[model samples]
Target: MKINSKKVTVQKSSQALCEYLSDVKNFEALMPDNISKFELIRDDAFVFALKGMPEIALEVKEVEAPHKVMLGALSDKIPFQLTANIETINANTSQVELVFEGDFNPMMAMMIKSPITKFLETLAGNLEQIQ
Candidate 1:
């Protein structure tokens, strides 16, 4: 299954956005309001829990410098890769869209689609306020 987030324009350049995303610690600011818990487990990994979901561990899986950052689920229970796609709009502006690719049975996909989409959209929307 694949889900795409809404594109958002950010005030920073793609390089700057990617730099911020490269650090797991920096993601604390982009968390949704429903995030019940968040903890940095390593320089490139973290664990977080939403109000009603299990705490999931995620790590920075791959980074393509100023273009893309891919984070993957640390648990096989929910196999997925979330990619942050950054586009250069200008010297001081960039665009961000999140793509979530998950391996789930059709039934499981139908069950989690709504909440997952909201989660991705919230994270993408928060990119505009990255500091």
Candidate 2:
């Protein structure tokens, strides 16, 4: 299934945003208060676990300067790809949105759709409040 976050305008420039996202460590700042585990594997990869979920390892798989970034999980248990699309509005401002796609069967998709959408919204909202 595919889910997209509402585009949010933030004070950060695209370059700065990309720089911030390219570092896997910064993802902790975007996570919710329930994050139970966050372990860095490399400068661009880490494994994390939420309140009730199994641990998942993710890496910043790809990045296009000042525009796009793609993060992918290493575990096959929950196959998914997440992309962040950034648009420059000015030198001091930009818009950011997230697209999440997961490979899951019909029943699994139904069960996860709501939480994934909520997670996307939370992620987008965090972008605005992040320094």
Candidate 3:
């Protein structure tokens, strides 16, 4: 199975948005209950608990702060990863778009998509709440 996604744009400065996304620690606080016990391993890398699932751990494989972040699931059950890419259109304006892809069992694959979408929506809302 393949994971695909996208997101709406944000009206924020690129540098400012990058600054906000620079620290992995900040993201943990913004994540909703679907995620729990979040931790940053190194720089933009991390391992976090995913709720309502198999207690899966997520790790950041690649990242460019507010511009983009690629994450992978470390769970045996799910073989999926997500790449969140953000762009700054103009001063005081930015946007976040995501691409996801993975190989998983039929039921698990179906289960992940919608929740992932919801999580992204929730994440966006939380981000907007800041600044």
Candidate 4:
């Protein structure tokens, strides 16, 4: 399954936003307010638990400097990759997009489509505050 987040225009340079997102610790600020547990396992990995959902662990899979960062799930329960793509619009602005690719069967995909879409959009919108 593929899910794309709404694009957000951030009032910050692409490099700045990329640097902030490169560090796993900074993800706490991007998490949903309803998350009950968040733990940083290392610079590249962390685990978080959303309300009523199983704990999810993620690790940085790839980082392309000021352009993109990819995170992959560390659990067999959910095999997915979440990527953040950054485009420089100008010296003081950047456009950010989030994409989520998950290995889910038709039944699971149907069950998760709505909530996951909303979650991805929320994450993209919140990128505006990272500056």
Question: Each model's C-alpha lDDT?
Answer: 0.93, 0.90, 0.69, 0.89
Which sections of candidate 4 miss by over 4 Å? none
Candidates ranked by lDDT:
1, 2, 4, 3
**Highest TM-score: which candidate?**
1
What's the lDDT for residue 72 in model 4?
Answer: 96
Tens-place lDDT per residue, model 1, 53-131, is 9898999999997999999999998999999999999999999899999999999999999999999989988987775
- Residue-level lDDT tens digits of model 4 in 71-121: 999987889999999999999899989999999999999998998898787
Clashing residue pairs in candidate 4 are: none
Residue pairs with backbone atoms closer than 3 Å in model 2 (clashes): none
- What's model 4's lDDT at 7? 84
Better of 2 and 3 by TM-score: 2
TM-score of each: 0.97, 0.95, 0.72, 0.95
Per-candidate Cα RMSD to the true structure, in Å, reads 0.8, 1.0, 3.0, 1.1
Let me know the TM-score candidate 3 reaches against the reference structure: 0.72
Candidate with best lDDT: 1
**Would you list the rank order by TM-score, best first?**
1, 2, 4, 3
